[model samples]
Target: MENERAVEPAGIRERLSGNEAVAIAIKQIHPDVFPAFPITPSTEIPQYFSSYVANGEVQTEFVPVESEHSAMSAAVGAQSAGARTMTATSSCGLALMWEELYIAASNRLPITLALVNRALSGPININCDHSDSMGARDAGWIQIYSENNQEAYDNFIQAVRIGEHKDVQLPVMVCQDGFITSHAVENIKLIEDSLVKDFVGEYTPENYLLNAKRPMSTGAYDVTSYYMEHKRQQAQAMKNAKRVALEVAKDFEKISGRSYGLFEEYKLDDADYAIVIINSAAGTAKDAIDKMRAEGKKVGLLKIRLFRPFPAEEIREALKNVKVLAVMDRCEGFNAYGGPLGAEVKGALYSLDNGPKVVNYIYGLGGRDVRVENVEEVFNELEKIDNSGELGEEYRYLSVRD
Candidate 1:
């Protein structure tokens, strides 16, 4: 007991996988209920929790579910009963729970899930990609992507705070590349569990409509009169979630000494051109940007972390000095105009003044590589736009077969 107080809640270093990082981060909040299923890369998170429960480190109900659907069902039931709950899944596992994923959001349940990003089957490989996440893009959860192990750990810690915030009662999905991040090991300086316990504090379900004492109805059949307004209320909560995320991140920074907000801006202050990308590709682009700058070229990178409630204001500010931007996406929008990330960038820039010219580059499909060299090609394409003073009529493919 004296050791608990002597711990001092300080930062400690350890090598952790994306899955293990999430497990450690969630342990801080001490979830009361977990109904988890095993899915590739996602399996280790719950496995860690199982060990925690067995070791008597966390006094919580750990439910080892047989299937994804049942796992989600347990989460909904637990959250409805006013318990702090969580779960994890991937690809088809996520699809199996799709029906409940929406319900968790619409019911305003503050549950959190870690998605070890995976590639959906058809032509399958147990590797890394964003297909699983992009497929569930509109599932109504507050979706955020992480580039590396540090981000995976950091975002998972912040997710509970943001999702359970009084103004933003919504489910959250923290996404990281399947095998790329989920399986890789990296050095992470973790805050003491005691500090995180104090930082995240506790979960208190507010405005819960389900109660035996109050005799209130929960998830009742809504008629046209109330259905639209109820959905509007959900939308408002989602918007409020963005601001609450910033506040949670701000408070988390005070305790952990690591900072992150809407998106990560890299060397954009005086650049004439920029690249807007997400996930692990941003790490690739960062390398390219650094190389180009060393060659006396003006370039920067903007990495989008939060995709669900897109950060329009910060998006505009990050590119304020740039004259051109290349928005690269891993997944395609098929015949649509642009992929998810590209479309969001354009949506954010419509209101900006003197903004840079933006082009969409779709590449790295089906677990392909987005090596650092590919970003140089994107910058070359942006230069073509700069010199010719004409935006390309079609999307550019970076290092992909014709």
Candidate 2:
């Protein structure tokens, strides 16, 4: 299934932090509007982007709002007026935009949000965790998680196309682990400005408030009878996004020679034990899996990328063969059972009568470290469960103090 067209040469290599990489991508796209309120970790994104605006590098209208709510509100207004809009936020900042998040998605606005994942408040910590985006998982926006700076940049660029596609006109959240990827600098390859411009193309929305000839109303109060229908349509659009995301990734790979999929399967084909995880910890898990593989332990991993759509069927097929499984969550769902990701992965595998024995482990809350040794310990437990044929506690905590 190869295209005849020659792949474009790789883009220039650069050293950048996740925030800086994302800022560069936004500058290259030259989006119409960016209404943002600064938050820790994610604050650097708008900081860098605003500098571009001031330097005349990009003509994007950079609005410094008073709060995240105003940021999202302005984003909705700008997007409704037929502009390709975007914004950035983290943790409580994202929590503040909760209401407007649904508004933008329900209105079918393709607004891109560069989300730096952070732990939500109470104990008041600033670090890498999926609590921010995980809390907003059901908000109807398409969610894409990145593992590192390179992925953050690449995912943000692809988000524009995925969200704006006709069948999937929904807002998008391009997420990366706060501080872990956001503040950490790494070598990344960037697409050329002309290539990115041509790839994203023009933002010609079909029906907008600004269109004089096609006058229409948006965000009107929906009666109960129509509200359910509107919600149903939004759900269908989310379903459509799974296909659109893959399509966009194919095009992206053609141009950049970097392929992406719903999830990354690392040595999972014939493993006896596997771990299902997300975001930055996946890198650590991979190293652990490699070391275990050399020792002839049948261990592998499934790293989720597209979280909102959940890709349930695909995930089930990916992990169906494993005898024991560990699902890691960086946030506390506080359910006393496990976390959000554990819930989703378990639900995905529910129908399999002889599916892998699944164990949900809550780990790395408030930016606690996840080392290769820690991941290997998880695999060691899975091996024990496999050999003993006795399932222990289904819900557990990993690398947490007694």
Candidate 3:
């Protein structure tokens, strides 16, 4: 949708790295409490603010934690005390904080975190993959992705604004591509501090029945019968987040003069085939789609911005007109399915009355290079399987050499 509203403020500068932009956005909100244990790509952000704390550029508690687990615990405690909290980590650091992440969300705390995407170590090395994100997919926090430096900065602001919105007091994780986008310098436009402050306003924790003398407990112990209800409450809040995300995204575009939505479409309007993907990989697919269009191939691309709340209906609707859909997964999920995102893409479109035939392509595992040509290879395979009898269990590895 066109952001046909007020002009964005002028201080929105023209150049910064994705991490730097994220830092600036956090400063805009002036979080009441920001805490962290440094982890790469993401670690630099907390380091940037250390001097700010010492010189009082930002009035916030910069906690020194021995581990990422403790960092999240500190963030949760601060959040419960009605303070806006922020922290960031990647890979193992993210895994360490897994438990508290869920607790913060189930208790409806607006703790916004930045996940500078990095490959989780197993064979023991630091790199990039969606493994960490897919593992935490069910952690009850909203996961939003930024494909570039600007979106990283923009979404960081929106995450705080949306997470703290009264109707949607849910924890949000903003994922930015580790070194590719996070550390890469981009010509980013920074919205002014005053404008961002006005746009985000202030954090106001809702006064639930547990306030003051009421003495109600949060995450209170519950038997089987009541436990289901609490889960239902969480489900409903997730639903609320979908609507709020769209509303907030539209407003953000108006305020920053940049546009984004649940997804971005490139030549998908009337294409015969398309690929549905996420994160920085989508940028690769977009380039391939452009090349295909030039060669007269009817292929397009759909980049997912909001993965949680799945937006299944929206995804189906977006790909309805296409004849075949190819899903590219960047992270493997072992025996569960061919890859994590491929599994989700299948689930999202399987039930449609007459959806397009879909194919899953596993690519870029362990940070293996996946260029635009790799995406085209998958698109070619998808075209070959367009009218095949097979449907489910239809995933493949695009660039694997025998």
Candidate 4:
């Protein structure tokens, strides 16, 4: 099945917001269960999915719960019982599901979550940022991010196959920036229903609680004698996910005519300066790269698509030659060192004695606007660092008022 191909199918073109695209994808997959609780931005996903259930478009059991914690709890139970289950959430909603997040992964239940990325609250913000998802980076789930509505839809569709693969039975988070991509309308090409169904074939778990012949126990308390081994197995599953994700993307391209990779490198092959970023802001940075290129500056961008099982070796190879690099993080890690992304990139390149001089910039917190100009300024700073041969402040903030 590694080299499997499906006849390229004609796409149904439509203009839709990110939330609508994800919901429509869910309708097409038509999972056995969807345990839902509405949270702003992500609410539309379940809202649209519920309408599909109401109209007989899908036969999925739509369980509307009172809170996000219960939403995830129900998802874990349903998935363990041999049902294909999924749910949607944002910021605090995800925070509420904290415990179940680990439970689903530890139980090896491949539940999909449509996460509209929002800033975690202290001041109670309802805007775009990576804090929520970043905070759960170690929760033993696979994470894939999107730059726009099209990627959001495509990623969600592919997530099912990635998570449910026998070698990688872990939950998946299909994430998109809140309101930025989630609310903004854009033209997209959707796969035909038949093709989507054919691609995401079926969910047949080998060992499930529902199978009478094969009795099983899940979420049992593990003492010190066996707890570490269970954690180790989860880590190994995450490692397998990296290979599984790329294989799934290869097959997806056969049906959709769109190609995907662990990360996208824009003009980085012969570039001197580059920026590493994720999600919707990657679109803005592309524009900035173009502007800088026209002025005879060699600038490029690496946009991450598969965030979890963080493609460290691949990322190191991609940016090994660049003279200076900036890792743009939308969340504040407050580690006094740098954001999560910064820490990951630096750690990946630590073994390379001549690795690019890297710096981390925290930006776009609480839905603050990220424009081409701001991205260009970051590139300009990279150029200065390259020329000066001195990297100033390894950790910094972008567009924050002093």
TM-score of each: 0.93, 0.98, 0.93, 0.98
Candidate 4 lowest-lDDT run of ten = 1-10
Q: Give candidate 2's error at residue 186 in angstroms.
A: 0.7
- Give the lDDT of residue 274 in candidate 3: 91
Q: Rate the local accuracy (lDDT) of all candidates.
A: 0.84, 0.94, 0.82, 0.95
lDDT of 1 at 167: 84
Off by over 4 Å in 1: 1-10, 207-211
lDDT digits (tens) for residues 356-390 of candidate 1: 88888887776688887788988877888899999
| Candidate that scores best on lDDT | 4
Each candidate's number of clashing pairs is 0, 0, 4, 0
lDDT of 2 by residue, 1-402 (tens): 977987567788999999999999999999999999999989999999999999999889999989999999999999999999999999999999999999998999999999999999979999988899999999999999999999999999999999999999999999999989999999989988998999999999999999999999999999998999999999999999999999999999876889999999999998999999999999999999999999999899999999989999999999889999999999889888889999999999999989989889999999999999999999999989988998889999988779
Candidate 2 runs further than 4 Å off: 1-8
Between prediction 2 and prediction 3, which has the larger TM-score?
2
By lDDT: ranked, best first: 4, 2, 1, 3
Q: Which pairs clash in the backbone of model 1?
A: none
lDDT of 3: 0.82
Residue-level lDDT for 243 in candidate 2: 97
